[model samples]
Target: MLRRLLGSPAAVSGHLHRSLSTHCVSTNLRRSLSTAASSSSHPPWAIIDYNTLVDDSPSSWAPGACFDPLQPPRVSRISAPPHLLRPRERPGPGTNLVQLLTGHVTAASADGHLLLTYYDIIAEGPRASWNQTADMEVERFICNPISGQLLRLPYVSGSRKRICYHRMGLLTQPGPGGARFAVADIVSQRERVIDRFLPELGRWDMVVGLPCQPTPEREMDMNQETVAFGGRLWWVDLTCGTISLDPFSYRPELRFVHLPTGSTLTSHIHTKSESAEERDEVAKYRRVGVSEGRLRYVQTSLHEPFVLSSYVLDEEASSWALEHQVELKQVLADGGHECKNRPPQIAVLDPMNAHVVYITLGEQEHVVAVNIYQDKVIGSAPLQNRYHYLLPCVLPPSLGSSQFPETGKKGDMEAIDVLVSCGRHYKG
Candidate 1:
């Protein structure tokens, strides 16, 4: 489990969808830093990535990983340099015709190499069993984020039907003595429309209408991102559903569960102290549950900052649905949709502690930590666009806790983080 979680190519885009809107949220955080600085006020740079949340001792999670208090930090008003420009125009990534696609996503890739993009493309169609053969074949490509090195898996030719690509994550599984990179493609065996491929194995396979679980196949209507945390993969199903993938399992699958009803969440909000104006504002934003268990999608018609929603997953369902009864308000902070929707690309790592989501934001070539634990934007920095976010992953035997530094402020020794502003992509 430790090594399998660490090996990936890097920078695969994944993310969740917003409620009551048509726009998409993604995490390839590309910043064109060379462009002129605009009037737009950038985010604050004071908070350190690691905080001394606990007073006396260092955070329990601090030792093996880094709670680097002295790490270089970014000043509030300063912005990093711009990104290197590409030819002004040409065939860019994701612009090709025969590409694997869906509108919504949650987490893109667990490691850097095999991206685990997600979609609520499933519709409320009908039921299918893992045992009951739907007779489908699915296929998709696992492409390189940079060179576009694609490994195409052969299609089940002349099958008279298409397969569906459910979801995939780059896994470093314990193969005898060590970890090996593998793409765990959750494909629907039914003559599913989506197909998938493994670049490492040089193999082809079918994707499907449903996963390996026993839930009835439903047509998902929305888009969502795929996320990796706690040694597993997770995403929100179109109907505000969240799915968790077991990283340790051989035949990878999501144990489905249901989320709290939207009304259950919104109705529970105490409107008592709210002013009429505030009440009106509250109406715009509600804490509606998204994933099964305790998580909710806290979205608003009003665009203030980001609001955080969180959940717990029940590991025993066949189809995607909510699980537990313990409700958590979690982190209700201000977040612009930029982190999820605005990235040019993204990468993820289990990092043994909590999930570390890396997006190269700005035209500046920087990685941004938009939200951690649902509330705070831990840190940000200017980084190479070509650099994969997967390279720094740490496997579990988890060194310590996954939380960021307890001390919100950078140490006196060095700055804790940095930021980069993006410019327009250069058309050569």
Candidate 2:
């Protein structure tokens, strides 16, 4: 009876045989799973990537992975005076745990803890004039911060013009055979369209029905940052509407939803003719992000004390509602010097903890966390100025390899090579 319930060895290994026959396991999957199964028997660690600004040194632009941000010190359970509990010290400038390749990190998979970066290599010498278009070769790569495994992705054919403006995102999950992952991107210029990379097929597939047209008068652009929430990928337009796509569907679907009336992010925009400087000034004060599985909008004013207004998307009502409105003075008592020059760039680092938000202050590039619910500053860390240009991604804890097969026989290796080389393409 026990043998029947558990199945014989042949029956137990049948699934593995089928996976080998189908050639579903990829090189990345094999490497990641094997490494995880052999490594220390501990939970996977969570980390974040901090992409620095341009620097003369070739290596300075690489991302710095940090593990300390999410692991706050724990308090003792033993009874004691509150004052006796030592406060947790903030991370210093030298706390970066790992340094990755130099490139523009375009997307991050919070679930898988993977990073996608785009690097442009000038094939020819410098052009004589800035207006002259030079030969540019673009390369895309995805890397695992924990394992330091990097894979070069095949080039996707399209207009290279304004490639820097393109947006990318990653999604991953365990499949019947092994782990599967997909990378998606949106390029908008002449026409708006979506492209996704399917690992199983090893090719790019385009999804239609995206509302890419921007009114001639507005000339709006899609925000470069993307959020993967509730099984859909979301992108916010500069004009205040969101574009969502379901990548896993048989025929991917795209939808756009407008922001609520009073919660419109453009409340501060002025229609009157103004100098280029004034227009750029207003653009610096607004940001869009996701928090607690909902879309969030943050807007700040140019005046003193920097009043910040935050809004949350009310999914059921199909609208946004004002969530928090707090002045910088109320939170950061000193009102750091950077506040006077420009508004801080805001990002919701911990969506699970809706109260905390990450903000980047001026030239100094001090990354600080503020608690909206408590109405106080929580932590502060000095970010190197060189890493300021890249977007900050909050990666969740690693999903260790223990979930996959611990070992594969020689036959499995042969099968994977044959399958990968054939370049079989599968459509969702």
Candidate 3:
């Protein structure tokens, strides 16, 4: 299907196959840095990407961050430097077209950093014919949008090639020199392993192997976003619960915390049978995030007398404490919307405000901010895309200088791409 749609990978443009270089910052980064410095802002923003194909519209390729702390939440797009979009090192002059497929805003940290996965296809050519399937390149980046600084992470090697399945997240630790960060890749299969990448070390270290599964009854389905809270990275399986580990610990210990009692799926047989689209639809009603320095889980009941329930994890990582429950029907009626049957999609948890949550209501997906405590709709705006991965990020007080640090070992780029049904091309 991808081959028929993309018309043989040779259809890519020159901008896609360019070689990567060591430039501190591009003109775009400098402009963004200037803009961020002057703005007085709130802590968290709703970050999402336009997963649609790239056409003549430039905004389609960029990821957007929606700021709702103040009234009328506004959204702005974040653009990547041209060099970061190309191959880290040139394969050859004969390299065929490498289509920039899409960008996934996989995770975010407390320090306003984002973990991005760029999907690209290396067209089959004489030099690139080692594989038959699309040469999907695993390009992982730690980007601070406010600082306009970006760091391309080194690829994890020594095992089989890295695909898009491994769950990853960004972990940040502030130090005297500057804010240091690490990438936690939770590789789960027959066995689960944790890989940590610190810039100072310049390579991925296989930290430890989990002694046992998070649950003995069924395997974990961790498709939701990973949360960075309390100096640890929390990988969430929305239907099940969450598994957290402090990536910085020398002897990392994995801990499991299930969803609020009665929220977890009792059996995996039904969940496993649902298609990916079905799973995404289910995610719209459930989410876990950090708010007011505590881990919170929120979900909307599927049946009527529709209710939105929120829970906060206890300090000891033992269990979840029920926080608030807002009746969605009453809220909708108060807001003057008559569509009682339309279920709302849980967009994001207000990282700074424990009582407020964001949701996309109706078919238009109008982004609405709701205060669960008061059952009031405070702010809203229309979102262009229906299917999106929304991430809540806290922008720092001041932007950091654009300093592209050295990762010691030369970086490697693996080429394998999957083209979705989207009709346009997107360059990230």
Candidate 4:
């Protein structure tokens, strides 16, 4: 009856086409059915069997049953080259040098060759009392580590005799062909002031006042470096709160942002120190840095198996979130480091990658790079140990002389003044 209704070949084709078009069957399903029917001539035994037969014997074993999916991934190890293992040399003229000063470290521009350093003088004269001095002179000068070029920062006219250099932050603004950089210095005398050095202006000008004044107790406890991130300068106060200032703002704007609670690393070791204050001070170790245009906070303990906790600023929430946590012992073991000394001190997070960090092991003479993302030590480089002080700074290649012009004869007087007044600040 169905054949009679279809009638001729044209009528059958029309009926098939109408069925397919009307969703009787999909085109792919029809094609697959036709192909399977055409290939069904072979015997079942002639077809190659690709599936493995289940082994039910007592001696037989299955590998998948023994596999553990919860196991941690293995870590990769990297080695430093022979040249990097040797003591670092002083950067020559026109070379990029990231100089680490007494109380501060530098973050150099990736495109610029020069590193900014300063000359400071701390003179101690007759004292009126044991804690107070009769006369103190503080002079500061900005200098280039590569060319030995010095530029005297104009002193705050009619300021107090005692002045302290609090912290410095360097920010580079990208321009058409090259970039321009600005330096913000926090100087404290009777009052704390923020001074900015504009490359175009060629002089230090007071920008704004600090939100909080520095007392002798808090002055010694400030972070060594002020980080430049999110178009502002940030300093971690002694209480681990972040203080920020906008240098480009028309009004003097300063904001204090409290870090999220429980973000700091705490130690469980009980010290035998007689003073309870000393024990409290030894309970926490913190470092503030910038990574990937965001502010980062790092905390670790002073003992072995030093566990590190890292956090990044959450801009939307205006808080910090714990990002990474790892043990220093595991990192050292993976790096083939067998030093019996104290655990390395985390210096700063890599600005280019948030997962990498720079650390300085005590008296090791080399800076180690650990990639927390991969759970390994990627590399190490010898640090330039001057005056037994090892300041590990990452220095990129210099751009050119046109970007950072040499300080010629006009800077001669400033260099002379720095040499004469800053002699006492340098310790042999």
RMSD of each predicted structure:
18.6, 17.4, 8.5, 30.3
Candidate 4 residue-wise lDDT, 220-311, digit = tens: 22333455667777755524466666665555455665555764223322224323334223322566766666777777756668888788
Candidate 3 structure quality by residue, lDDT tens digits, 1-428: 23321222111101122121223222232234344444434433544432212222322222222112222233334444333455335346666654444445667887777776555555555423424566665566676655444566776773223653456888888765556888887776246578888777777888546664355355665657788999989887777788888888777777788888898776743465664445455676899988888999999987765799999998788799998898887786787654447777787888878988887777745777788988888877776544354567776554333223443234442211111111111121
Error in Å for residue 78 of model 2: 39
Q: List the candidates' TM-scores in order.
A: 0.35, 0.63, 0.76, 0.53
lDDT of 1: 0.28
| 293-338 per-residue lDDT for model 1 (tens digits) | 2233333222223322323333443232432121111221232324
lDDT scores of the candidates, listed in order: 0.28, 0.44, 0.60, 0.41
Which is better, 1 or 4, measured by TM-score? 4
Question: Any residue pairs clashing in model 2, and if so which?
Answer: 52-387, 53-386, 53-387
- For residues 1-428, write the lDDT of model 2, one tens digit per residue: 11211121111100000001122223332233344334423222221333311122322111221112222111000011111111123235565321111234455554544544432322222222212333333445454433333454555754332333345777656566544556787655235567887655455677665543232234234443566666777765544566666666667656655654543446345344543334333334555665666677776655667777777877752557888878775467653434645666553344556676666667536666777677777777665322222233443434433122111222111111111111111111
Best candidate, lDDT-wise? 3
Cα deviation in Å at residue 300, candidate 3? 0.4
Index of the highest-TM-score prediction: 3
What's the best-to-worst order under lDDT? 3, 2, 4, 1
Winner on lDDT between 2 and 4 is 2
For model 4, give the 10-residue run with minimal summed lDDT. 64-73
lDDT of 2: 0.44
